[model samples]
Target: MDKIKVLSIFGTRPEAIKMAPVVRAMQQDDRFLPITVVTGQHREMLDQVLKIFKIVPEYDLNVMGKGQTLSTITNKVIIGLDTILENEQPNLVLVHGDTTTTFAAALSAFYHQIAIGHVEAGLRTWNKYSPFPEEMNRQMVDDLTDFYFAPTSQSAENLRKENHASEKITVTGNTAIDALKMTVQDDYQNPELNEIFDKGNKVVLVTMHRRENQGEPMQRVFRAVRKVIDQHEGVEVVFPVHLNPKIQEMAQKELGNDSRIHLIKPLDVIDFHNAIARSYFVMTDSGGVQEEAPALNKPVLVLRDTTERPEGITAGTLKLVGTEPQDVTNAMIELLENQSIYKKMASAKNPYGDGDASLKILDEIAKSIKR
Candidate 1:
């Protein structure tokens, strides 16, 4: 059999993290030849994850430019991929999650009459603009996709609800959990981590760079965390701050100057996973962390009112604390004070996966192309 060629495309940190497992899986499988392409939509951050995964893209779109708008990114990816598709002409084009890169790449593949595979497909808040363009991006990408790699059964059902072909949908768990297999190590060391370990403090890993929680909501959550840390003597927070000027400014102003709260620069996949591995708990407004943390046996306190991964909540691995200061404070306090409650959350079975997602994805890809 000829090796099936698959061009896997992604642009952001989250997409890179989730796609790393599938890329690595394909590299080891003799049945497929994977061509990696990065749109450079998130340039530096995307490259950082690529380095961690040791994935050198067969092609880089380099579509990123200063002061680029969503429309600009969408248009550039379509145009850039025009040349890429003409060259690589893979059996399948695989795109991950909802990004301008995901939607545009799928659109371009459709234009060229090539089949597309959507990794992390069928996640929906259904409120079109709730997640900005992401909701629409995934919806449009799915419309063009020939394969659906949903991370969970619920997500597969979501695709079915939208009338996506059930035969095409594969519940492969989340590839992010699979990535931790390569990233988290016992010897992983960082200055902040050493300090936290030296102090023997209960560490709470914090990440709050969501579009919804930008200004006031972010400040509120930061203030709540600050208050909780103030009240708890043995607790410390390590926040890998996002590079967005608005988020940076707010995080520094609200959470800075606190000795217990270490505000560091954004970390790559390896560093972030290592930190999560060592943390006692996690507090975040991001979607990926909600799925990733539980596999490490860390309880995640979601900063949003709702989550697309309700399976985590139902399985007792995640708690949606929202951004309200009082609610956030209460949730934090309950975990800090109640050992049984903390144990219950920390010991819950990870509903996301058992870290075999990459193998499943590769097998499905092989079967799809073989047929």
Candidate 2:
């Protein structure tokens, strides 16, 4: 049997973290030839994850630029993959999650009449602009998708509601859990991390960089965080600031100058996972961390008002506090002061996956190609 050629496409740090396991699985499987393409949507951060996963993309789009917009990213990814898709003509093009790269790559595959398999598919906020381009990106990608790899039964049901064929959908769990297995180590160490761990302070690992949460919302959250940290002697925060200039400026202006609040550069997958492992809990406006943090038994206080990952909320692993200062501050205080609440949130079973998502994805891909 001729090995099926599968081209896996992704760009952002979150996408890279989740897709790494599936891509690695395909590389080892003799039944498929995996071709990796990175849109370089996040540049340095994307490269950091790629390096940690030891993935070398055959094509690097290098799509990032000064003050790039959503329209620009979509245009760049579509244009870049046009020739690649025409030349390689793989049996399937696999796109992960709901990034601009995911949508654009799937569009390119559809234009070429090639089959597209969407990993982490069928997630819907239903509100088109709630997550900005992401909610629409996943919906549009699923519309063009020939195969849907939903992380849970809820996501698969979302696909069904949209009239996607059940036969094409596979509930393989989230690959983020699979990534946790590879990243979190018992002896992980970093200079800053080591110092924090040595201090014996309760670490609050924070990652907040979303278009909606920028400006006043972010500033309010930062102020709340600072207040919480100042009030608690044993609590410390390690915030990996996003690379966006606006975000950096805002984070530095509001959250810097405090010894208890450590503002560091964005972390690679390994460091970020280890940080989650070592942290007492997590606070973030990011998507993947909502899924990943729970696997490490860390309670998450979602900084956003609305989340697509409600499974975590239902399972008691996450709390939606939004960006209001009082709400944010009170949630932080509750988790810090209330041991019973913290224990309940921390011990809840991760609703995402069981760490075999990559293998299941591979098996489904192989079966699809055979058919």
Candidate 3:
């Protein structure tokens, strides 16, 4: 029996984090040959995740540049994958979540007439521009995808409403949970974090980098966080600031110069997972963190007004505080001051997955290709 050749492509940190488990699973399974490609859309951050996962890609497009637009990323990925697809000709191409890389890779696979499997598919804010390119990217990729690996039943239902074939969609939970299983360690050490722990301060890990929350929204949320920290005596914030210039400026302006708020460089996957594991709770606008934090048994205060991952909210692990200062302050106070509320949110079951999504995804792929 000939081995099924599977090509997995991703460029950004979020996509890389979610897809790593699936790629690693393919590497261990004898039934398939896995080919890895990185578009390098997010360069440094993407490299950080790849190193943490120990994923050495067979190809790197190096597509990142100063002031690159979405159109540029899409075109670069499509053109870069063109020759590779023509040469390797994998049986299927797997893309994760929504990014320019996800859409462009799916587009490239479609151009080559290759089957495409989308991981973390069917997520919808339906508003299209709510999350900027991501919401649209996932929607369009789903149109081109042959297999839809929906993380939750809600996601699968979204696909169904959009007229996607039910049989082609698999609710394999989230691979982010699988990643969390590999990343968080009992003996994980970080000097900065150690200093915070030594002070007996409760840490709140934060990651806010959504296009929608850029200027005013980000500033509002930052102020709310600062207010909460000021009111509480033994609480600290560890924010791994995004590299975007506008964001950097806003973060420094709103949250900087505060001893309690540690504005640090972006973290690698291992450091991030360990940080989450050590934190009291998380507050973020990141989609991956919504799923990952819950699995770590931490309550999450979603900084966005809307979320595609509603499973966490329904499961009581996540609370949508949006970017309103009052709401954000209230949510933070409840988590900090109300022990019962904190326990209820912290102890809620994680709806993402049980950390076997990669195995289930591989099994489904094998079964599909064999048939």
Each model's TM-score?
Answer: 0.97, 0.98, 0.98
Error of 1 at 68 (Å): 2.2
Over the stretch 247-363, how does candidate 3's per-residue lDDT look in tens digits? 999999989999999999998899889888889999999999999999999999999878999889999999999999999999999999999999999999999989999998998
Residue-wise lDDT of candidate 2 within 1-371, one digit each (tens)? 89999999999989999999999999999999999999999998899899988999999999999989989999999999999998998999999999999999999999999999999998888989878789999999999999999999999999999999999999999999999999989878799789986798898999999888889999999999999999999999999998888999999899889989999988888988999999999999999999999998999999988888988999999999999999999999999999999999999999998999999988998888753
Q: Cα lDDT of all candidates, in order?
A: 0.89, 0.92, 0.93
Q: What is the lDDT of residue 301 in candidate 3?
A: 96
Model 2 residue 182 CA deviation (Å) reads 0.9
Tally clashes: model 2: 0
Ranked candidates (lDDT, high to low): 3, 2, 1
lDDT tens digits, residue span 268-287, model 1: 88888888888889999788
- The root-mean-square deviation over C-alpha atoms between each candidate and the true structure, in angstroms, is 1.4, 0.9, 1.1
Ranking by TM-score: 2, 3, 1
Query: lDDT (0-100) at residue 316 of candidate 2?
Result: 99
